[model samples]
Target: MTSGPSSAALLLLADGRLPAGGHAHSGGVEAAVVDGGIRDIGDLEEFLRGRLATSGLVTAAFAAATRRSCPANGPVPDGIITELDIELDARTPSPAQRAASRAQGRALLRAGRAAWPGLSCPLSAPHQPVTFGIVAAAAGLSPADAALAVVYGAVSGPASAAVRLLGLNPLAVTALLARLSPDVEATADAATVLSERPPADLPALTGPRLDLLAERHRAAEIRMFAS
Candidate 1:
């Protein structure tokens, strides 16, 4: 069996460190929790599963697709990247959520470019998945690996946030990760297949309830998360 990249590097992208500003956004979990939609750990898991099925899956697919399309040692393609960005923008209906994703994407790009030179990242107009895919490619991770990392990051960010907001047990939360590993792997596999195709061929499976909550959360005066 061929060994993949160093575990340390994979951890760097997946560790939730690297200064991506992901901590500031909760992937709509905060709104769900505050509104009583996500009341316990079970609710948190369900919410994250739905997110993975929709935006999370789409984002991973785009990232993996970009990685697949990008040359191993050539300039990143701007056109495809732009297409993914616009797609993400259209999918994210809530203004607040759009702003949040862009803000985080820009931050991730800035940090990624600084850490890995020769990384070509667009300005902050596009959403997070675009920037994330570019950064992952620059980091030398394969498309499948990038897809898995992106999917894991998307789900874990909110899961971590729930730990703080709901005061859930850390051990239990870690255990949840183990249980959800299969789902994450499956999503990544699906994303990789989708990435091979054009964005037009991609399915539009965004969650309306999540969008509604994000809109309502934006109107709130006091909020812990950016979106």
Candidate 2:
């Protein structure tokens, strides 16, 4: 309601180094490597592209919607948030992935609450993207910024993991990320269009291979990333 969040807030949230426990998760890259879905930078490109389109778009939409739902003043409505949570659950088909998202969400909430108490987030256990939107609202950012932040993380997390998992050159990986920025922005814009949609009307984009990898990652006795 007030001036939407500033560009500084957007940068802070999009920062991969932000202490949200995101470094520990690979955004499914670890499982993909274990499953032989990714072997080199070429394969990583494909994986990143698919993730940016599917899970990336879906989560970004939720975050933008959540950002839009927050009131400029007064307590947040828990009922609406509850419905949003359910919508998130409906979109994510994998239990392991769900737990992973909630974990990241909780971590981000902790950081966000400490950083900006003004946002007055209502939930203790939101999906990562949902919490991200609330944090953006608290930071005074717009829905478009929220979408960009979450979508950027969706791709960057895995790209970073690819560095560790595959021992690929970081410079090349970064360049790949730069090349993909246009798609990320496009996806963010598309999500912003649906930010005001009803929860039932939110995007439902599932990645079957990612889901299977998450399940397999959960069962693995020894794993590098959380999900």
Per lDDT, the best of the predicted structures is 2
Error of 1 at 132 (Å): 1.1
Best by TM-score: 2
In model 2, which regions exceed 4 Å deviation?
1-5
lDDT of 2 by residue, 1-227 (tens): 12444777778778888899899999888988988889999999999999988999999999999888887465667877778888999989999999999999999998898888765656778999989888887787888889988888989999999999989999999999999999999999999898789989999988998999899999999988887
lDDT of 2 at 115: 86
Q: Any runs in candidate 1 off by more than 4 Å, and if so which?
A: 1-7
lDDT of each: 0.80, 0.88
Cα deviation in Å at residue 14, candidate 2?
0.8
Per-residue lDDT tens digits for candidate 1, residues 106-202, read 8888887897888875455457777877877787777887788889987899999899888999888888888898999999899888888887666
For model 1, state the Cα shift of residue 218 in Å.
Answer: 1.2
Q: Each model's TM-score, in the order given?
A: 0.93, 0.96
- Among residues 3 or more apart in sequence or in different chains, the pairs in candidate 2 whose N, CA or C atoms overlap within 3 Å are 5-140, 5-141
